[model samples]
Target: MARHLDLEEQEQLDELKHFWNQYGNLITWILIVIFGSVAAWNGWQYWQRRQAVQASFLYDEVERAAVGGDAARVEQAFKDIKDKFGRTTYAQQAGLLAGRVLAETGKADAAKSALQWVASDASDEGLQAVAKLRLAGLLVQAKDFDGALKQLTSGVPREFEPLAADRRGDIYNLQGNKDQAKLEYMKAWQGFPADSQYRPLVEVKLTALGVDVQTLKPAGEPAKS
Candidate 1:
């Protein structure tokens, strides 16, 4: 009985050896790939966190400069954030802040430049829409009507569409296209909700354009006869 047990153990050991010989290299390679992928993912997450931390610091500089009304300082800090962390949310917010400060300080060109960058490169659609609106306003002030229209029409997020239409109406009015202006203003007036403060704003514009505010309805409502 002892000799038989010894033989069975020997056979079992040999079978285990044979299985390892058949699959060892494949299992080793699979484990190496899994470990390598995990390492790469961890490295990527660390890098992104580091970038956010650095960007937040730089954005604080921009905010301080903007609060101080220092257009030049705001411009410089915004440039730094955009250059180093352009893909970060901090960069987008910095651009908007820098542009507003620059505009308030009468640096129209520089303000336009900052806003244009946000409109063109921002990842957030809302940010891009705001940038475009501000940029369009500056362009209108500069009498670049066509350029203003281009920015307003290029693309506006759904929530901003009413504002964009209002801006288009303003542009059309400025260009002496009263009919088109009224049309755009009506679109704006219809876009807003009944109780929205912004809806009243558009209604005022529509009133100026000779539209009866009471006759206007919410976007999907039928016209009263």
Candidate 2:
């Protein structure tokens, strides 16, 4: 009976060895891949957090320079932020702030350059829209009317549509196209909600065009006869 039990144990051992030989390499590789992926994900999250913290510090530097009215310092800090963290939200905010400071300091060309970079390269759609709108205003001030029109022609986010229409109306008025200007002003007036402060501004535009804001209905709404 003892000899028989020994033979049974040897048979079980041999089967276990055969199973390991068949699948050992594949099982080891699967575990390695799963653990490696988990480690890589954790590392990526840590890196992104570190980058955001660093970028935020750089943005604060740009803001301080801007508030101090030190254009040179603002420019240098903004340059560093853009070079190191251009993909971060802090970089985009810095671009907008820098553009404003540069424009206030009579650096129109530099302001346009900064705004153009944000308009062209910002990852956020709303930020891009704001950049484009500001760039269009700058172009208008420079009397680059055609260029201003080109800037306004690009798609803006929905909340900005009314503002864009109003700007287009201003451009048309400048170009002596009163009829088109009134049409755009009408669109702008209709686009805003009744209680919006901006709606009253649009009303002023329409009033200047001999169109009574009280007489026009919102777009797509049926007019009462």
> For every model shown, what is its TM-score relative to the native structure?
0.94, 0.90
The numbered model that scores best in TM-score is 1
Candidate 2: clashing pairs of residues: none
Residue 195 of model 1, lDDT score? 76
Error of 1 at 154 (Å): 1.5
Cα lDDT of model 2 by residue, 1-225, tens digit: 999999999999999899989998999999999999999999999999999999999999999999899998988998999999999999999999999999999989988988999999999988988998899999999999999888887878888888888999999999999899998888887888888788888788778878866678988986545
lDDT of 2 at 207: 85
Off by over 4 Å in 2: 1-16
- Check candidate 1 and list the clashing pairs: none
| Root-mean-square deviation of candidate 1 | 1.4
List, residue by residue over 3-112, the lDDT tens digit for candidate 1: 99999999999999999999999999999999999999999999999999999999999999998888889999999999999999999989999889999999999999
All candidates' lDDT scores? 0.93, 0.90
